[model samples]
Target: MAASNSIAENIAGSPNHKMLHGTLQAAGLVERLGGDGEYTVFAPTDAAFVQIPPVTREGWMLPAQKQVLHAILNHHVVPGRIDSAELERLVDAGDGAAILKTLDGRDLWIRRSGASYILTSGSGNKAVITEADLAQKNGVVHIVDAVLIPAT
Candidate 1:
């Protein structure tokens, strides 16, 4: 249909982007990802944030928790643009699963669950790709159903 925007701009335009935008801004990563790159961001939707306890989410938003927020957010980002098709291929090649290194330096397990894709966080939390292949000027975005907290 229409040309896609940068990841930051795309997030800004979505209904579920508020919490993510806040976290990105608080982490000081918005400007970085806003620029051109072949990045892949597994963006969690607003509903995904709801899965986190309110107090936990509140704590993460505090200035004192900036580093934690940054790490958590970075865990959702993988370098290079990985679209759904490529991801599927990777999973297929890996026999239904593939390990992806995130910007935070932890591995995220991507697997095929029936007709959809599932992302297993380092902490063992699982999120589904509710929407995929959101093409952006910088890269791509996959709207996920949960926030991926890295294992401690």
Candidate 2:
């Protein structure tokens, strides 16, 4: 909640983002992501992760699947401090949608859905930003309603 904290600190402190923190930790990205770097994250909530099959999700956390997990998480992050206003401006500039390059170099489409901001992933899965503009020391976080699939 405070701007003094880093993105990882913010996620770790949030009740809705515990699952994301765990995933980051599992992927060996906790230290890297938590370090001094700007990142705009489309963070999925616990409920969103719950939608994935338990076995499949559990397997992703395995040590052997660290690269896969890292890639998946990277798909949800952009290397900057893009907040809600900036995202909206980008959408407006693009006339309806904006293409955001994820940390993994995948394209993440953001479009306006009335008052909500919808994100479409490369796998065609869509997610809505349920909560936005969570500012931190390194960047901002936007809590999404679904886990936007990564490019295969």
Candidate 3:
């Protein structure tokens, strides 16, 4: 396989990355996570943001809403590079499913649906992997269709 690019590079190269990267930076997670090591981020595309209630999105971006923003962002990330194949193997070895712990101290469940991978968080919200295997230096990024929100 070819070498993976850095998150910064990927953000710079992709139009979708621009807004996502900016949001992460504004939340102050970019620097801390940038140098930590590999991470697997379940990146929600701009289109995914549309799925969120408009007021919720506006609230998260507010300066006074930093804590909420951080939690939401962290909820989308796993500390290591958990590629799709590895995720499949893990699920298959554990009763056809497995629970992945997130950086935010929440559990994300992984399961298979025929050939597709499904991820679910505590509130029973599900996000399908619209695009997988975009490798980055700090980790891997899987683009999803919906935003993963933590239970309130």
- For model 3, what is the alpha-carbon lDDT of residue 49? 80
Candidate 3 segments whose C-alpha is farther than 4 A from its true place: 1-4
For all candidates, what are the clash counts?
0, 0, 3
Lowest summed lDDT across 10 adjacent residues in model 1 is found at 1-10
Off by over 4 Å in 1: none
Enumerate residue pairs that collide in model 3. 38-138, 39-138, 39-139
User: Model 1, 1-152: lDDT tens per residue?
Assistant: 01367888778777887899889988999887888677999999888998899999999999999999998999999999999999999999999999999997899999998999999999999999998988888888999999999987
Model 2: lDDT of residue 20? 90
Clashing pairs in 1: none
Model 2, C-alpha of 64: deviation from truth (Å): 1.5
Local distance difference test, per candidate? 0.90, 0.90, 0.78
Instruction: For model 2, name the residue pairs that clash.
Output: none
For residue 143, what is the lDDT in candidate 3? 86
TM-score of each: 0.96, 0.96, 0.89
Model 3, poorest ten-residue lDDT window? 1-10
